[model samples]
Target chain A: MSILEFSNVSFSNEGKSILKNLNIRIESRDYISIVGPSGSGKSTFLKLCNNLISPSEGNISFNNKNVSEYNPIELRKEIAYCFQMPHLFGDTVMDNLSFPFKIRNKKVDMDRIKYLFSLFSMDEEFIDEKVLNLSGGEKQRIALMRTLMFTPEVLLLDEVTSALDSENTLIVENIINKLNNEGSTVLWVTHNDEQSIKYANKLLTLENGEIKSLEVLK
Target chain B: MNSGATLSTSSLIIASSLVLISLFFSYYQKLNLEKETIIGVIRAIVQLTIVGYLLNFIFGLKNPFFTTLLLLFMTTNASFNASKRGKGIKNGFLISFIAIGIGAFITLFILVVSGAIKYEPYQIIPIGGMIISNAMVAIGLCYKQLLSNFKNKREEVETKLALGADILPSSIEIIRDAIKTGMLPTIDSMKTLGIVALPGMMTGLILAGTSPIEAVKFQILVTFMMLSTTSIASFLACYLAYKGFFNGRKQLI
Candidate 1:
């Protein structure tokens, strides 16, 4: 069964059509890289999966149930979205890291956080560091780590590594790829063509709010 | 000592020349406010003259129906002004009316029931005007803060929303900030009540030959009621006005 599916979805914002009748399906563990022009609805497509903005026409389904039928909060938990521009929450890195647990009414998993810190090659003291002083690449990594705190079934990456240098990008990619191998579906959107084909098994290209091509890279 | 002190028409004419000083400053500084100063003075004279005769007639008549109608008119006018300042919020006038109306009503009800003031037109109209007017200003501040905060903090809010937060949780910080913004002025005024500036109502009573102690009593009453109404109004307005910024999909509009 497909983990996420969109059927005849059309989205319009402020009288301008963003995405038009997009039909998509992704199985569990599918690493799909989406490349598109700025306004070709790349971020909008990811947002729709999480029900951030509902389609004006047709329906989106997660786990074979209509997305709107599920509580939006619960659905968003399963489908975490990482934005293109990184914004750290509150003052310290601890705030963003503990937020996912706080929202779920669960205890913060310190050991798990420490484990994540090692994966990103960040020192443990960075937890208390103020995000205001963190570099853009560092902030982006923290934001991604925060999203992964709860281990969502689907991780929607909307150019999350855009701010990262090549070294940092490779570090983030390796970490995220490990998560993908563990059965978390990854739908990454990026403008870099080489990055699009580097790891993902599938590449989806969009132009003018319509899918231009889909290829199985593997 | 100054009770019944009246300004005759000729006396008023001489006093009116004081406005020329402001016009002179505007001319010297190139402020271009001469027209505004002239219009403001004329409007003040015209509006206050009408209100004075109307208040005199209404006070003498002692009709409860007229008093209630006048209070409603004032509340509606205050609501309109507050709503006009909030162009972004949908149904701003209706929201302001409900928030200010309820806040003013609760404060006035307590005052009337406690025998602090009578429901007569003389007392109720002025007291109601003060309460409703204060509520209007607080709600206007809340509206302005809500509009700006939602716009400026869009990424933070959406990040929370995308992280499985309900609208209230995602918007909680902004809502609290807006309520604080609305209520801060009243709290600051409370701190400096007697020390910084004499309140308009108390000063007027003193000018009209009321005893200093009596004027102080009324000022204290006004101060307490203003705090009560603004706290209630700011809370209600922030909670109610926030939903306007979110769409049915729970996305920030």
Candidate 2:
């Protein structure tokens, strides 16, 4: 079953067409990369998927259900989005990671948090450190870990590694590849062709608010 | 008669010096605050003069109702000033009212019940002034912080919402941080009160013929009252402001 589907989606802000006649689909476990220039509506597309922005026209369905029919908050749990610039709250790293669980009233998965931290090569001691004191790389890792805590069925990554150094970028890219291999549905947006080629199982190229090309990678 | 004459002359000298010094600082320092300084100095002089006469009458009458009315007027005006400073905040007046009302009442009741302040107009007026002024500062700071946090961390807030967090929890940190930042000025003032500067209450008490030790004691009491009132007001204002930032369904406005 297609986990996510966008059919003839159109969006405009202030009567200016930001997205027009865009269509795409994500099968279960598919790692899709959306490549486009800045203002090509890549972020807008992700936002629509996450219901941050409603489409101006056309329909979006998730798991064969109309996107509008699902509660945005519930839909968000199933489909988490990572922003381009990670913003951590004025709290400890542990608080940042456990916020999703705390909000939902779920038990803190300490093991999973530890595992994610180890995977990102972060120190366990960082859990007690204030988020304000964290380096950029540490913040990005903590932000990703926070999003992943809920184990969302699909992850919408919007330039998640764009602000990171090359070393940190590699760490994130490796994690993305691992997540994809482990059967997570990933929709990633980036202008970096190399990152797209590295992890994308399916590539969707957008231009002028429309998908110009769709290619399946081996 | 000699003491009275000395007090009057000293008051005039102090008032004039404050005005001249403020003007000189505004002009020579090129602080861009010349207009505000001039207006503030003029307003202070006029307002204090009026209040001085009013206080003479009130002290003579010493009626509880009039004192209560005066307290209410001060709280309401302070709350109004707070709301004005918190522009772009919806229903800010309501938030300020709740903040000032809760903060002032709690602190004043405690002070009165503890016998720190008598139930008379003299004690109530000064105590009310302390509470209301701090509450005003607290509300203003909390509102400013909340607005700035919302502006800077908007995406993070949206991200939380998209991650199944409700509006309240999503905004809890912002509100908490804002309140903390808002309370910092009050905390700093308390810390620097005697060593760095003599607070208005202490200075006023001393000028009114109270001994230094007595003036210091009153200042300490007022500081404690201000701290408690400001904290309560800031917390209430922040919580109320958060509600205004959302819709009926708790979605961000």
TM-score of each: 0.91, 0.78
> What stretches of model 2 exceed 4 Å from their correct place?
A1-17, A21-31, A54-71, A87-95, A114-142, A160-184, A192-202, A213-218, B1-42, B53-65, B155-159, B243-253
Docking class of 1: medium
Residues B23-123 of candidate 2 have per-residue lDDT tens digits of: 78879989889799889878987999899999878977899999989988998899899999999788888889888988999998998899888878877
Report the C-alpha displacement of residue B139, candidate 1, in angstroms.
1.4
**Residue B19 miss distance in model 1 (angstroms):** 4.4
What are the clash counts of all predictions, listed in order?
0, 0
lDDT of 1 by residue, A11-124 (tens): 999999999999888888999999988888899999899988899998899999999889889999999999888889788999999988988898999999999999998899
Candidate 1 positional error at A81, Å: 0.3
DockQ of the candidate models in sequence: 0.67, 0.45
lDDT of 1 by residue, B60-82 (tens): 99999999889889989998999
